[model samples]
Target chain A: MIVGVMGPEGSYSEKAAKLWMQKYSMSGSELRYFADIEDAFLATVQGKSDISIIPIENSIEGSVGVTLDLLLENEAKIVGEIVVRIEHCLLSKGGPEKVRVILSHPQGLAQCRHFLKKHFPDAELRSTGSTSHAARLAGEFEEMAAIASPEAAECYGLKVLLSNIQDKKENYTRFIVLKAGKKTLTEPETGSEKCSSSACKTSLIVYLEKDRPGALYEILGTFAKRKINLTKIESRPSKKELGDYYFYIDFEGHDSDALVKDALKDIKAKTDTLKILGSYPAFKTFRSVNIDKGY
Target chain B: MIVGVMGPEGSYSEKAAKLWMQKYSMSGSELRYFADIEDAFLATVQGKSDISIIPIENSIEGSVGVTLDLLLENEAKIVGEIVVRIEHCLLSKGGPEKVRVILSHPQGLAQCRHFLKKHFPDAELRSTGSTSHAARLAGEFEEMAAIASPEAAECYGLKVLLSNIQDKKENYTRFIVLKAGKKTLTEPETGSEKCSSSACKTSLIVYLEKDRPGALYEILGTFAKRKINLTKIESRPSKKELGDYYFYIDFEGHDSDALVKDALKDIKAKTDTLKILGSYPAFKTFRSVNIDKGY
Candidate 1:
């Protein structure tokens, strides 16, 4: 199967996509790169890519709203998940002192803002297409430095001026693998029952009953009553009128579990629109680190 | 009161600060411009500014996570709130037969991404410090246009290629006014008893009880049972450890109100920590319009 990913080449999304291929143990998997996440989604939707991997959220950065919005807009189902540890570094050509401008992705820039303010407050912080691009530029220009990955510095032949520059040490990003067709895993096999997703968690996109006040309370109450643990819950504008929203929720158990099955029944009763994005295993856990080291 | 805002001058934040000053009918309010929201917060904390205004969330874009993170980091109280309408424009140097690049702030660039991709499929989308900065560059350079405010276009002497170019027409941004100290306005000689905010609102930061199952459920149950309507609820990283969080909540009715007072008392009983921010009247309904129309 061909896995579509976002890139300027060697971006975090691309790295996450590669890790996903390895985790699935898919041999000889073809890779396709798109300019942005939307392009990757379109490739999957058009059957150009069998599975598409995209970053959905980060621990330090919060939700990737555009990715969530696209998942809701496109009818694609999330068939799997992956989480990758993020490591940032400062790369420069003529060393740190010679650097007049620092470049990185907007999120990368924000993550390193404190470090930059403390060290190089007067230096201009420019936004680039990706961390990889920033590293590439840092390597090419004498008066520029970039906040990126150590791998990126090596790839671009730049000196690593500082390592682990992120504001938070346990920086991790959650990515989803989307497919156009119906999910392959069914029933109990969707959870740990199957070797494919034995350690995986499940995510759901649900819309609640609008006319009833406390309908959302009742819907969340179902999960609470069931003792089901939720990892995340984010609300997005459903493009409907004001006060209407689509709630995207991530939980520990798969749909086939008795508790989840019962919660779905009560949730369906209170929901106006409910769609299952997919049921996949959670990504591998990354160990936490020092926030100061990340920058 | 001295108000701190994020701007180079004539930015959206400056406009919002002016509106806040007028609402309080406080004349000759000093406005201090900062590089970003965090800097403004620091200014307030250091007694350089009495109040700081910053955009916290956008309807189309969801949460501004950095602002939320900064709020959690600094010991500042959220004193008031406002929602400003956002209207974006496309400006250019008059003779652009071939537009190679379009520039905007990262947030603005993200907001208009779909439009840019559809219209200029091959053109590069660049990021700048702000919309006003983009317009200034576009005015000085020949091969560029900018996505910014119409007033920005006028101020920088750029031609308006398009107006209201944003994908969504109903785009609105919710801004939070923060301060180091909490102050309350009660019905007094200058105000009438019929004032809407005499029975004000209260914002709080609460940490959930323990890892016990259904703990948050029980806490939310109290609000539901008491018929308290929640205006907003968001989770931010506690940073003490991975997976721990603090919930920021906003609801109608002051803490002194019978129902709300009971709700707070119950919430505190169940949660690990509860800190009240402040309560004030919402923004006066204001209609914003295009620059040529003098809104």
Candidate 2:
């Protein structure tokens, strides 16, 4: 099986793909890396790859808006999700004192801004395509350093100058797995049909036709009335206007659950656009192997 | 008399600051530039600057999380808001034909990704501290082109080779104006108190004590039932966990409005972290001079 990822080897996306494969007991999956998120996502959408994994959100940086945008634009269905703990390390050929240029992906650099400012304030900060790419560049110069995954040091033959260099503790990145072919969702049944998802989490996107008052509130009322616990709720711009938005929400309970089904029905009627992005298993918290429906 | 912004002279924040001053009829305010949102915001928070402007959200890129995070952490009050239209242009000392490297802030670069891929696919995309900084670099080299505001072209003696080059049309950035001092709130009067805000827009941040079922719904219900229209609603990571979030909501009523006041009373009771980021004038869309109470 071929799995597309948003970055080269040693990227968090690669780690998420590995974790996702392990959870499903699918071993020996071939990982294909792409330079950007759009390419990796489109590879899955166009069936150029069997599956793809992409970062959806980060604990510190917030939701990956482009990923959310691509998901909506491509009608991509998320089959599962894996959360990867991000422990950024400073890698270099020499010591921190000799580091004159600090390179990282924009997100990586932003995440470690406090650390960089405190230690290497004079260094010229540069943005690369991916954290791993920074590692590769750092390997070529003694004065160049990278803020990237610890695995990047190993992949690029560089020394770990400092470990866990990110400004925050317990930084986590969530990656959603997308399959090549979208499963055509049939009409949600009245709880008589068998549950398609063994997992308890469901995600959907909603876009109100107008930026009208009480439109979103009315939609949220559906979930509230059903007592569904939302795990995540985010609004990305529709790219049409400043106030226009597309909300991506994650909540507990499978779509097949009677309560969830009713909420979905009610929300769909209220919003002009409501696309069920699929349900997945709860989560595999980093380093813990335990997986359950968490009912 | 000092106004703070997140970037140098030619940045969108600078433009927003100018617009805000013009709207408030405050001429001759000094503009102080900060390197990042946190600094610009904290300048206002610390009273180092009387007022500071920071980008809150973009039509394409979505909410600036750090700005939201700082607003909540500092308990700063917003007294006004402005929206600046973003028109990224390719600027260089020379024409586009000799350009081999394209530089901008990460957001500017990301916004023009499609244009770059189609025309200058092989050109190196480098990131600088700000788009204006990229313009400065472009001024030093003929081979370097900057994707920046048109004002940057003038600031750095660069020619605009292309205009309106962002991936999407109608791009806008919403900036919230933060003031240093918090006003002491007397008990909210029941229709007896004069309205604190003349503008019809209000902004607030809420953190649910727990990700409990119906928690957020309950808050939205307060506004929905009162018919207070929400113009923008965004969720930023609480930075504690994956599912934990801080919701920022913008609505169409002054905080002094009876319905809005009641909603605030109800929402504050339900959530552990409910901060009224102050009510501000709705907005001054780019190139438009009309300002009203908007009620």
Candidate 3:
């Protein structure tokens, strides 16, 4: 199996890919790194990779708009999800006092804003393509530092100047694994023996029939009536005009379930466009395992 | 009156401030520029500025998460809103061929990605604090170009090498004017003459009583039952836990309306926390005005 991810080799995305591999027991799978999220998705669609792992949302920063946008436009299905705790480390070749420049991805820099402001107030902060790219650059310069993962420091042969430098200790990023093939969805099964063995999540995008008053209320009513718990809901521009939006919603339950099918049917009747992005098992949070511990 | 905005002078916020000044006939009001969005909001809260105009959402990019986060935490109320068309221009001191580096705010650069890739693929792309700041730096060097508003070119004494270079031509950003004082909301008036003179929008954040199934359904039911039109609905992590979220919803009709008042009363009964962010007149779309034309 081949897994695609955004990278400079040792990015958080690469870490996520590793975590996902361990969770699914897909050891010995070849990992391919793409330039960006879109390219990773494209690789899966073009059959260059079996699966593409992409970040969907961050605990502090919220959703990744580009990934969401690509999901809406692409021909891939979300098959699984994994949440990775983001622990940023300040890496440098020299001591903290000698560091005059700080670098990381824009998000990495933003995550450690308070730490940087208090310690390296005079450091020139710069954004690179990835944290690992910053780590590689920091390794070459004695006066430079990078905000990245501890794994990145090991990868780039840089010493950890500071560990867990992010503002929030519980920061996490949820990544969805996407595959090219679509699952076969049937008319929801109605039975006392509910297909609830695995906690399932159905993600879909809905466009209202018209920009009318109470349109969304009526659409959301379908899921509300079915008592389906919504995990997430967000509005994105329809790209047609101002005020017009397409709602991306994630609700609990599989598409094969009775209530979800009924809800989606009712929702489709009211919406001009209704695209079921995917159905996947909801992610369960677990304590971070030491990656350095050999499995 | 003094208006606070994100600085470097010739930014889209300043342009929106000007439009707002015209809309309210508040010309001759002093415009104060702040370093960031949070600072602009702080200025309003501190009485340094009477009102602060900040971008809330872009048609293409979705909501500004930081602005939304600030609104949730701050004491200010949204008084009004204005939508400005985002027309990016490539500005430089010399011709396009002489440009070796491009600079702009991250969003500005992302918006003009296609134009940059097609024309100046080899140019180094750098992110700055503001587009006008980039324009200022671009003006100082013959080999530097900035993606900014045409107004920035005029402000920084640079030439517009290309106009309307954004990936999406219909791009528009909605800016909300926030004031320090909160409005006292009352029950919707029971009168034959409804206060439907202007299209109004009510923004609020709701935290459910518990993370229960159909908790959101019941919340939406209040609005659905009243036939209230929801313009937008989004969930942001409560920063407490991964699954815990606060729903930020925007719906039509002022808080003064009878149905809206009834809905809120019911919603408050069911919710643990209900905050009425503010009610403001909905922005109307209009053709882009020539900022260069004399007022």
**Tens digit per residue, CA lDDT, model 1, A64-153:** 777888877787877677676788888897878898888887778876767887888777676666688788777778899988888787
lDDT of each: 0.70, 0.78, 0.77
Model 1 bad stretches (over 4 Å): A182-200, A208-212, A239-244, A284-295, B94-98, B121-129, B182-199, B209-211, B240-243, B284-295
Interface C-alpha root-mean-square deviation, candidates in order: 2.7, 1.4, 2.1
Ranking by DockQ: 2, 3, 1
| Candidate closer to the true structure by DockQ (higher is better), 1 or 2 | 2
Tens digits of per-residue lDDT for model 2, B24-101? 667878999987677888898888898898888777777776787788778678777778889999999987899998
Worst 10 residues of 2 chain A by lDDT: A189-198
Best by lDDT: 2
DockQ of predicted model 1 = 0.41
How does chain A of every candidate compare to the true chain A by TM-score?
Answer: 0.84, 0.90, 0.87
Native contact recovery (fnat) for each candidate is 0.20, 0.78, 0.51
Candidate 3 chain A minimal-lDDT segment of 10 residues: A188-197
Provide the TM-score of chain B versus the true chain B for each model in turn: 0.83, 0.88, 0.88
Candidate 1's chain A scores what TM-score?
Answer: 0.84
Better of 1 and 3 by TM-score: 3
What does candidate 2's lDDT look like per residue over A1-295, in tens digits? 8889977688878878777777656787788988877788889888877788888888888877678888888867777777888999999999888999898887888788779768986677777767887898899999999998888899999999899988788788888888654434443422112343434578888988654778777777787777777788888888887778888888887776677878888886776678888776666332367532110
